[model samples]
Target: MPALVRAGTAQQWPQALAVPGGVARLSLGPAAERPVVHAGDIPVLVLGDAIEWTAIVGIPLAAPVGEAEVTVQAAPTAPARRVAYRVAAKQYREQRLTVAPRTVDLAPEDLARHERERAHQQHVMATFSTPLPEGLQMRQPVPGRRSSSFGLRRVFNGQARNPHSGMDIAAATGTPVAAPLAGRVIDVGDYFFNGGTVWLDHGGGLLSMYCHLSRMDCQVGDVLRTGDAFCRVGATGRVTGPHLHWGVMLNRTMVDPALFLPA
Candidate 1:
């Protein structure tokens, strides 16, 4: 299992995980309304009622393993308060595979397509919505054996690639994938690497993505509640087989999806 570090007064979903590319939830006592918290310049999610407010911080993968902070502004007129957090180093294992040459070395046209998709997906993942969700607990989008591949440094055809950013669930082709939380469809497209993908904006810098889908039932701007079937699993993109690449993004950074999964 991947090591996790957590801190906070929150009974559920605590504030800080010192691990690089982890999440921190900060509790800001009592508020008239939801406060605005910034993890750097990006707005973090503030969730609460007329009572306490909490900020969900997404620690980046590149963040140095040490102390970090976020700024919280209770109201528009109020000054921002800096809240301290810690980030610890977590080592990920390396995996090597021998795949087809084409999969390892992309053609010029494929590379161009990937660049465009990356830009568009980045915008979609950065979406911040009003009326933040109350909690981070999420239902499994599909029923299958969860592969602990998150953060695995992958080498394909002797070439080092980026660490895996999402959790992979091994499932059969055409397996249904459901929305883990209420969200609006912000992006749906076919890409070079991700294949058919769907991005959901779940308000307040909390987003979810489903990739390598065989079919997409939801379109952009569509609203879906938890358990709504939005797509079917497939081996569309560059994949070994049919499975769902589920990702959770907080503050525009991809954190471990397992953090949001039910215990």
Candidate 2:
């Protein structure tokens, strides 16, 4: 089957109830054939048959829970069409954790190193490649129980920290992790928080990241297909045990990885 034909049959758009810090899959239908869509200013992934297209929208954690809109342009001379979607409210659980004080508070040198790492990651997350992804359905990178820690507002040692941005899968150290979809490896690095991380660009603004790996098998610019082993799970970062931190990025925002799981 052709790539677009296969993608059209495999991908199903989620309903239009956009939850904060979540994802909203909107269908443009036949009218949007060959459309270029954007959620706000950020371009969204559009995939489907010749008659219809679907837009995968990433709702920011801070996005207002209400009506939201996306712009679609079918051609260069065609007028942009605004498609509105509803953003529903979702309440994520709060978690309080007590860890080593130094982990929360870094020294001057550690802080500087962290700052540099953050800048580099920000650039990686902002990558928007041409040729949108064929499909968004993803296979789990490793076989394990998923931790219900995603989107959890965490308070560490009486200090508020950012919400958990990735889905944590508990696995044994050195467990092989596979690629969730076909994509090119865009970034690979070890950082202060995410050790042995690999980021894949699944075309357009769709990206996925695997962090805290015990080993990396692929290098930057490597093309990986679905189910291909690319890394190994481990307790490499600031974590309690061996696990895989899998993140799905859309339009530069880290949305819930569960959204891409097969229904």
Top-scoring candidate (TM-score): 1
- Write one digit per residue (lDDT tens) for candidate 1, span 134-233: 6667889999997646788888888999888889999999999999999999999998888899999888888999999999998899999899999999
Q: What TM-score, over all chains together, does every model reach?
A: 0.91, 0.89
Query: Under the 3 Å rule for N, CA and C atoms, how many clashes does model 1 have?
Result: 4
Estimate, for each residue in 157-191, the C-alpha lDDT of model 2 and write its tens digit: 88999988889999999999999989999998887
lDDT on C-alpha atoms for all candidate structures: 0.82, 0.81
Model 2 TM-score is 0.89
Could you tell me the C-alpha RMSD of candidate 1 in Å?
A: 3.6
Q: What is the C-alpha RMSD of each candidate to the true structure, in Å?
A: 3.6, 4.8
For model 2, what is the error of residue 19's alpha carbon versus the real structure, in angstroms, after optimal superposition? Answer: 0.5
